[model samples]
Target: MKLKTPLLLLLVALTSCGNKPDLVQDNFSFASTQLKQAFVEMDAVRSAEPREKQALRDKQNLGPLASPRNVEADGTLHMVISRDWTSGFFPGELWYMYEYTKDDFWKQKAREQTALIEREKMNGGTHDMGFKVYCSFGNGYRLTGDAAYKDVLLQAAYTLTTRYKENVGAIRSWDHSRDKWDCPVIIDNMMNLELLFWAFKTSGDSLFYNVAVNHARTTMKNHYRKDYSSYHVVDYDTITGAVLHKHTHQGYAHESAWSRGQAWGLYGYTLCYRETGLPEFLEQAKQIENFIFSHPNLPKDLIPYWDFNAPGIPAEPRDASAATVTASALYELSMYDPANGKDYVMKANTILENLSKGYRTAPGKDRGFLLLHSTGSKMHNVEVDVPIVYADYYYLEALLRKQKLEKEGTAIL
Candidate 1:
């Protein structure tokens, strides 16, 4: 890919200011090598003794578990089945590799990984249809234009719509947290709306578009604080469409802003704006950016503590995953706001630079996961300060967005 002249000059100036030159290219190179090892490790695990493997495979709904989720505390690679929300992220990373390198090898790898998750299209019991299906099949279709992938996407979108409660105007997020929330809707659900929008476009079904729009509007009304920070979960009265509770499942407290939740809002609304050209979504995304960047507690390195209100402050674990998601969102948000485009790119570049310099795994470490120090849920003490799959997925996505901006003067939608 060749950089357009003006963006090339702008990127050069931005890199000279602080970032390492060719940061995007260098990261992708690092990712390619790391991901190759990830594949080997995953393959080895899947080739375990037949009886033991079959029992494990049965737990994953009869499919081989190949997607890396995280490394366990004891230095073991943790792979998840398609039913896991995170299963799609590694495949998405593989797609990103193919997208950046245009290498047939990565394409084949992505296809193989993505195939493992195709069964998720019919999984309606969980609200993570988008996370499970779109991240894998959606990217696959986008790159390959495979008709089969399109069918999977359509089915997944339909399955996701099943979770949308007409009274609540939002998709139910978790079915298991029933004792706490009658009809729970989460900020994370915003990320899934993109799959619905794509389904509308592909199938010409206005229902998908309307459901996504209504969900975005509803979440905007109910989930946000005065400062634009969001609550992690909002429980609704299924009968009356009234909010029953607003609290956090993953943040420090009920009122705290979960860092990854904020990043999800940023990325979600930006894509909503891209898909709908709605000024409200664009304005919402900008407000979220302001809240994040202007917060005093955000680190100098641009990574965030697990929660903005976490009591530990500098002692808190940093979530590199949040930074990567925000970086990727800002690159696209920059395109939508020409007045602030350069500033957004500069900020995003700084984040990428910082993450690359400090937050990445040491070379040949961590079973090929790229970025490190991501907290899955500090409140639950899960995956604290560990390398998680989604962090690497968004890190590569950010790099790809930066590359597209420099080369074509536009970020991919």
Candidate 2:
């Protein structure tokens, strides 16, 4: 029943995902009036775009499902359609839009965009199956309970598990060997565990669940530093399972924390706790939160410099993507911890507010990207200070989470 899949390597390394079902009671109270303007404005912006037609401009990025990348040399916004991790995010965006508005236009667009990336379910070479498939199809299944989406998701999990090594007790993150990296695992890989965990729950398959658990445990053991800040990449010896090297592929230095990488770790482990109810995962999430929020470099607006330790400090470009992810993770984190949840809820609200004003794009502008100022790989000198699809995806996701928490007293992770 499991069909075999893959992540971004050149553009990103092990791009992004989660865990068990938790019985959560939402007790927090908040007024949801402010976000509706952003929601309505963004919806109108998205509705105005001919996304399906524009996506056809770049088959290299995957085709009609391509999301906006950045401005090309011609001063027009460029879109990319790759088997890259971010490909599925566009569809996920539409899914969220549908969820938020209950409009048939978003629903139809979601289906069309989702259909373009179905081939990725069989792409087993990359480790980003969760970002590629689950973000799109997983949402589809969650919303519609379509059996076809379920099949795609199950096959995607099977493909993802192929990358797991019993010796390493982790799924290999990158296939390429750079320097002495024989088997490289990036922190971003932590985000891919959601698909496997979801598969186990839906199919009653232990292989998927066990692999997800082991990978989370392994990453938890090795990825974190003393302050709970994380290394972006950890290479391992295939046979001995020893760490070969630790470096930041996208951060300022090998020792610096990449903001989005930190976001990935926070979101990933928090999700693992949601699925497994493991206290360790929750504690890890807290430690990560402490490291990020307590860090002196964090802007008062909650958006972070591309790397917390980037040399430029305040001069560095802020990564709205990291802020969006952190806010989204914090909203989910608020569900389980009574002592910290209130603070997290406040933090999440502040982030949403800052992003809506400082980072939001006007209607019919910036290629209809929801949030701006996301940095992709500052090291590669690409996608810097640009609108990124994942930033928007998580931004909308955080907004939806806030809306749900306010209205139903429940956060849907």
Best by lDDT: 1
Candidate 2 residues lying further than 4 Å off, grouped into runs, are: 1-65, 72-74, 178-180
Report the lDDT tens digits of candidate 1 across residue range 73-179: 77888888788899999999989998888999999999999999998888888888888889889999999999999999999999999999999999988899677
Ten-residue segment with the worst summed lDDT in candidate 2? 22-31
Residue 357 in candidate 2 has what lDDT? 62
Question: Which 10-residue span in candidate 1 carries the lowest summed lDDT?
Answer: 57-66
Query: Candidate 2: how many backbone clashes?
Result: 13
In the range 1-413, model 2's lDDT, one tens digit per residue, is 53333223422333321132111111010111212333343445446668665565554444442444454334455544547678888788778877866778678878877887788898888999999899899998899899999999999899999999889999998877655688888899988999998988988989998999899988888888898999998888889999878889999999899999999999999999999999999999999999999999999999999999999887999999999899999999999888999999999989988886678765545655666789999998988888787898888788889888988887774
Strongest candidate by TM-score: 1
Candidate 1's TM-score: 0.93
TM-scores for all candidates: the values are 0.93, 0.84
